[model samples]
Target: MRKLTLLFSILLVSLVSAQTLQDSITFNPQQQLNAAQRILSGNYGKAVTVGAYGEVTYNQPEALNGELDIQRLVLLFGYKFNEKTQFVTEVEFEHVQEVFIEQAFVNYNVAPNVNLRGGLMLVPFGIINEFHEPTTFNGVERPSVDNVIVPTTWREIGFGVSGKLNNLSLGYQAYVFNGFQSTSFDGEGGVNGVLKGSNGLRSGRQKAIQSTIDSPTLSMKLDYYGISGLRLGLSGYFGDTQAEDDVEEIDGANIGISMIGLDARYAYQRFTARGQYVHGSLSGTEDYNNLTGKDLGSELQGWYLEAAYNLLPQEKTQRLFAFARYEQYDTHAGTDGALARNDAYNRNDLTTGLSYHLAPGVVLKGDYQFRDNAVSGGEVANRLNFGIGVWF
Candidate 1:
């Protein structure tokens, strides 16, 4: 880890020095837009913009009946108040019934390379949490690590600064956000804590729905694209969970958390590769678990590597990609006092599939997964998945 840090520092310095020497070139804000920015960037005038994206999926477990559903449909609405300020929002419909305000934020361009943003926004944790448009990723479903460990689509009300350094090919984000909820109480005086061993901090996502903030969290992410055909990211999050007012003074009602993530993506000719690693440590878990009667782990870790090759020629409007990925994650990587680790929490998956892009904004996908766990004599179920994704 130290070596990796040193190498990143050296590369960053070299890029900065090179950029300093080329200060004469003009900077185009459009050229510097990242994936999220591109999605939010509307027409070049002061007007309202509308867009939508959605996915339909089918999944079949071995020896089980297949299920099909409209996984998600998101509508994007943005208004450019002026060149200097804009408001963007996304409304999501999950499973054709559940509704959510995925993001609703205002951005003010304070300078050519910096912007001040505020409102309910996505947490910049890893790749998928922010750039999760249906057409943006390969596979019928997202990586398991992203789903369980990093908790994709996690969001909270926050304020932050974000921008790009075009010359250095770097983009940066820093935010102060509301943290997760560790526990809550019911009207009937029942303990309803959200944190558990099965999904780590996933269930704690407050989603800004009349959420409480006894503690604030800090999140930051840096993206480097100085090297041709490659993109690298480093992310960090730190803070403590919140508890309902009723349990505000109770011991173990909240836990301190610190997490870090590293990810990279590379594309060269017909080949592409990507990987991510995430680790988190929890403080006061022992006491928290004892109080809530929950099985929360002290440590959580996960990682995955994927590679893909395009089978079609570059000139073709349509393309086909064959890909494979291997993933391993453990929500119970470490247990607290008197808590026994659950081997079922230690799991891995092997997935292979094909993605056919019929157009830039439309794709058909199919994949099979071999899922297993560390438990002896465990009955693991494999799955086959298919999906269609569209964006416009």
Candidate 2:
């Protein structure tokens, strides 16, 4: 912890010094022109930043294969060459030792209303779908409904555009990247049960894995804040995903997804009201020609809705804030099309939480969640969680 604090202090000093130099350079009109000339002459501006967070939870099903773990961390660094171009990336260490590159992307701002960004980037969707900060949203944790259906932080090697016009902001992304893999034919369980295989371009596993596949995906989101203390947004995504197997030609085994999301928030002084709704669909045909006339597995679909209210009394001078959120989800909203076959899988979740703002860039939070897997023939369980979050 002392080392971390020392590193943070050094970073703070660097940022302050850079800001001071920039201000001084821009103070004079001629210096400003010279600065522009220097940039046009290939001079580059850069920055180094850091961020971290942690979470711990306790659950009632600790003895039933569900142990509450105190594990979760994410760090990021970013740099910019000019006002029109930049790069940002993050590395997430979950479960303590498992490290993965969460995101890495280069952005070019072509115009105030248009940008051409490539590399891996968050699939722009509803509010917290991309940047999953605890305080940025209302819940103690992300909505379970959004997690499985829309898949938060869902990103792939893709390009997209984002900008604002008047009170409306729009963003879009599309890519061709590795898709999800199914470990079991039954289709609904653990994270390993939904594991995704790496692309062949990275390793030789491509030749031995027949179930490896790549999917085409796209997402779009729009945000509008036309009224004071009120902001609203919507997002949607579509994709055709599949898995390949050499033993069986699982042709036309493509998946199609459709999502509709809505969010509204009102903030005045210390009081805030927010709510969100995301509806999604997952469908595909199970065809294995090499399996000798074998076509099994069922189509999937799900949706969920959530709401929260933040109570912050005015006239307070402490560095603290409190909030609570209520969430609910349904794995099968409507059993139409080919989704009726998977009607046996359904779940619901409810959560409530509180948060404290210890400083301008730090937050402490705690919450309780109740989940019911109605189809798993299991009883409902309660979970308690607490964590500290930070960003810079």
Candidate 3:
């Protein structure tokens, strides 16, 4: 009896120590070195780290059959070479069939506030493009503006520098990356263009799969969080699209692009709010449209605003938040050549949802979306969505 009691006491003490250690570690997502530094500072002397995040969703559109899908499953792998260098990668599976390399990068800390990174990296555009973990946002589906305008999950092969100023509570990133491919040769003496009026540059993403580069693009972002509960971001991208070697000399093979974005997020007690605006201007669209027989737009714009309130007490480990968002986007905000603006490309969405945080890295979400377009006599297809998300 005494031996068993002693063993129980030892186990209890060890468990208490582990719990204490875990409770003492705190992380700030707004910090530039949050991910890499967390691993190096924690991990209990381990050099290798593994993590994952995923989401499963069900959608039911009005007058349409419901569909259930494993929207995304991503596995994270990281290796800490030393105090100053680390490698991180995320492998993603979409819809249970398609596989993608979402992010693969090497970060080298050169100074206390500066780091250099390279490889396939997410573009630091709007909020969702860079901070897209499933549990990080409230809605079951991402804001439509992020999808249609900012083009979430947009990443490219690049090298750049990122750092934060502790005193100023500011972060910055700047990189030179391979731009989108506007037109590519099909190898059968035919040419195909990916840019269109409906989705702007979304379909032009090469995703680093044998990506070709005709011109290097400049992308940069600045974030400020000096205010207690507010964060602001400004981003910009400028470049010309790439074309296949065969089409490089063509009159309208590529287009020049300039995009800018602004976003803000705030949290005060149990209330939170966020907003974003993105605008893009395309040059040479008239010539490209005539040559490719496509209706590509000259200007694209989108914006969204959201607010949420937590319903649960702060002392509890779980939380429930009710949120509402409004989004507006226009892919054909302007047109060039003989092309006319398409009212159907001007869209808006109103979404209201509840996100239940069952634990720190797990959540259940439900939302209703009223979707519409500017086209005359167009029918609206509202949707109901439910989803489960997890991150670890």
Task: For residues 137-205, write the lDDT of model 2, one tens digit per residue.
Answer: 544566665565556656555666765675343333334344444322343421112321111001111
C-alpha local distance difference test of each model: 0.84, 0.50, 0.84
Candidate 3 lDDT over 123-223, as tens digits, reads 89988887777677889998888898989889999999998887988889999999999997767876788899889999999999999998899999999
Candidates 1 and 3, the one with greater TM-score = 3
Candidate 1 C-alpha lDDT tens digits along 124-211: 8877888677666678999999999999989899999998899988899999999999998866776677899999999999898999
Give, for candidate 1, the lowest lDDT window spanning 10 residues.
20-29
The per-residue C-alpha lDDT of model 1 at residue 123 equals 92
Clashing residue pairs in all predictions, respectively, total: 0, 1, 0
Q: List candidate 1 stretches off by more than 4 Å.
A: 1-36
lDDT of 3: 0.84
The order by descending lDDT is 3, 1, 2
Give the higher-lDDT candidate: 1 or 2: 1
Clashes of 2: 1
Model 3 clash tally, residue pairs: 0
TM-score of each: 0.90, 0.70, 0.91
